[model samples]
Target: MIAATPPANATIASTGAAGETASKLDAIAAQIEAANQRISSNAASIETAAKRLNTLEDTLDSTRKGSENGLIVLAKADQRLADIQAQIDATKQTQTTGAEAIANVARRVDSIEMAIAKSAAQASQHETVSAITGKSADTASQPALAAISQQTSEPQPRIASAVPAQTGGHITAPDTAKPAGDRANDAARTDLRIAEVEQALAFNKAADINTAKLVAELQAQVSATQQTVAGNTDVIAGTTKRMDTLDASMARMDARIADGERSLTANVATDSDVAKLVAELQASLASLDKRLAGDEQSLTDNSAADAETRIRVGALEAGTAAIAGTTGQLQAENKDQGKRITSLEAGLASVSATAKEALDRAIAAGKLAEGKLLFETVLSEAVAEFAFDKATLPKAAKVELKTLAEKLKAENQNVYIEIQGHTDNVGGTAGNMALGQERAEAVMTYLNSEFGIPLHRMSALSYGESRPVADNKTKSGRAQNRRVVLVVLK
Candidate 1:
């Protein structure tokens, strides 16, 4: 047998596939750079929106301050108006009292003047009666005049009486030709009434003088009060006008505040812009997560494939290590092995076929979602389920794998599945490898049963304790090391 030589066409196929993969990686890199630029621009927009929102908030705060100050001013204005109204009311009450006092003083003055006029009229009538009766009334009138002085409207003048006292003064009797009773009575009454009128005139004159004084004082007071009231009215009017003006200004301020509120309500773009920026940032973060996941998967797959290829290449070299003695046959065998190298290369490259084809199809169809793939790489995720030393799959692990399988089914594309089982270095390498393999197979069986993914498309690999994402020194790390990975390449 010719050392099981592989096909010669494998080299040409690998070269073509490599060229295509390189082109795809370059395209992916360029797209990732574009996405980064877009993300940066979106960040700047978000910053601008934040600044604008801050400015609006500041404006709202200032507006509130202004409104508070306006309310304070309005309260002060209201207090002033109340004080002015009180003053006006008090002034009105005072004016009414003052007017009543003036009326009383006027009535008293009129009464005094009427009394003096009546006294004067009675005196003139009595004197006219005496003059008509003549000299016959003199003797009868003398006693009558002395007696009649008691019944009269006139008060005593404290001056000389009509009949003088005999102790210190002399009196003359009137000459009478006959005794005339009616004439005598009339003359006596006239004399007494005349004396009473003179006394009343004197008393009333004195009263008039006092009354005049009182009238003058009262008039002066009334005039002063009028002036004061006039001044108060002017001041009240001014205050009222000022209050009206302040009320109008306050109303205008209220209207302006309402208008500001309306403007704020209408300008929804401010809030919407900020919300949009936040949503975009979330989208960018999600995109970054997906891209990082793809990149990590690609790195892992590349490493595993490279290691497998190196092992195969090393084995071929070691098998040919003792071929120096059979030089002629070894040369023939070298040609055969050269063909075998192509077979191994083709087999290794085939592992990435699904990813390459899917990416190429996406590019051709213009269905490339931005930020989903940062580079040409397999999309893979892991679910760890193995216990400390156990190879059995937990229910929780099954649930996670089921969810992952559902996602894979939704993808609806050709995909290569890889299950990698790892274990802590608690046992011998052989035993660990066996356990790892069993765990990996358990995962593969679940995927096959759940989604009917062909067995050929899925492979199980055992890393045992040789590969660990965490240190095996600690219990947590050892637990972490004992896990399985589910990788999907697209």
Candidate 2:
């Protein structure tokens, strides 16, 4: 086996050799330190950026919370205003209902008082007529009766709630209406009838004494009813005034409710404006959120970059330390280096003599990888007349390839074959390529079928007219160019 050889020999010369190597190592170490310093500065910058990003993120969060709180407060205020307005409306409605009830009470009281007064006036008229007629003084008192109560909405009369159960008396013919002229006419007619009756009664002394007693009784009853009517009229008037005051108060409440409703509408409009502001804030927040996300992603990316830089710095440090260790070893080995260099130089001459084959192999490896591997052994033959454009191999070509394949089969499996077919430039480039390919495939098929060569061991290539050893201007040159070449290699 060929021996391994060092690329170069080094001698520790008497000229401060260890110091020279130490200087080089120090220079490498210095470069490493500088790289580390640069890496540290970048990391510092990244850290500062990250802190700023975090602060910005926190600020955004606080701002978002404040915006949310503002929105919530506005919503609550709007709700409160709505509730208050509702309460005001309800209060206004209640006042209205109360006023109506008061008015109804006042009307009922007025009806009772008016009915009493009318009945009293009618009774007084009846009593005066009786007095004038000179009826018996022992005439019995009439049962007391109250007039019908009037309703506000309906014209029908019903019992009045405020009217007393008993009064002083009832008239024989109670006037339905209390108009002054109608009452005067009725009184006058009754007086005329009474005068006629009195004249008749004057002739009867018993009737006259009875009439005097009835007149006294009638006068007393009339006086008592007049007093009752006056008292109730005062009460009815007071009640009417109270109802008017209540109506005025209800109207004021309605006005206040209208104002409150207007205020509520304005508040709702303000709420709408607030909502628009909130929407703008939300959009701003969304944009901020996107910016924050970008910042976070950048931070992550920067962090990763920083980590990679640190890893590289760590490797540099390890390499610097290794270099330092090597420098120390170099110093220790310096004294014996001259003798070892002599021995290495002597051995290197022999290795250099055998290195050409190895170098050639390396060069060929590169060429093979590039698909430029040269054929070491080339065999060429002219294919006898194949029918025009036919791919069938000529008998002479087949027989020669069979003989070559038998010789190749005697070699090891490392052997590989390449069949190259060429064509004269007779037509277009495309047609020539196809023809060349067909001729190469025909030759390759003959080799595989006749000689048991694995298809993998053989490769067919078409040169077309691009690579011709002969000129294609003449017939003989065309005939010479249209040939197949079989190449063998390891």
Which candidate ranks first by lDDT, i.e. highest?
1
| lDDT (Cα, 0-100) at 140 in candidate 2 | 38
lDDT of 2 by residue, 187-286 (tens): 5543443344334334333544654565565556556555655654565466557556655755665676566566556655655665565566556556
By summed lDDT, which 10 consecutive residues of candidate 2 come out lowest?
1-10
Query: In model 1, which residue pairs have backbone atoms overlapping below 3 Å?
Result: 355-490
RMSD to truth, every model: 18.9, 29.6
lDDT of 1 by residue, 1-490 (tens): 0011121233334434556555655665665565566556655655665575566557557655655665565566556556555655655565565555445534433443454445446545655677888655454555544343343334323322221111222212222322345435644644554455455446545655766575666666556656756665676666567657766765765676566556554444554555576566567657655655655565556545543544455455344434334445645778765444544333224323433544454455544443132211111112243555676777756666666677667877666656666677898999999988998898889889877888876777787777654456875456545766554544
Taking all chains together, each candidate's TM-score versus the true structure is 0.30, 0.26
Q: Model 1 off-target regions past 4 Å?
A: 1-184, 195-207, 237-241, 244-248, 267-269, 276-295, 306-490
Ten-residue segment with the worst summed lDDT in candidate 1?
373-382
On TM-score, the candidate that comes out on top is 1
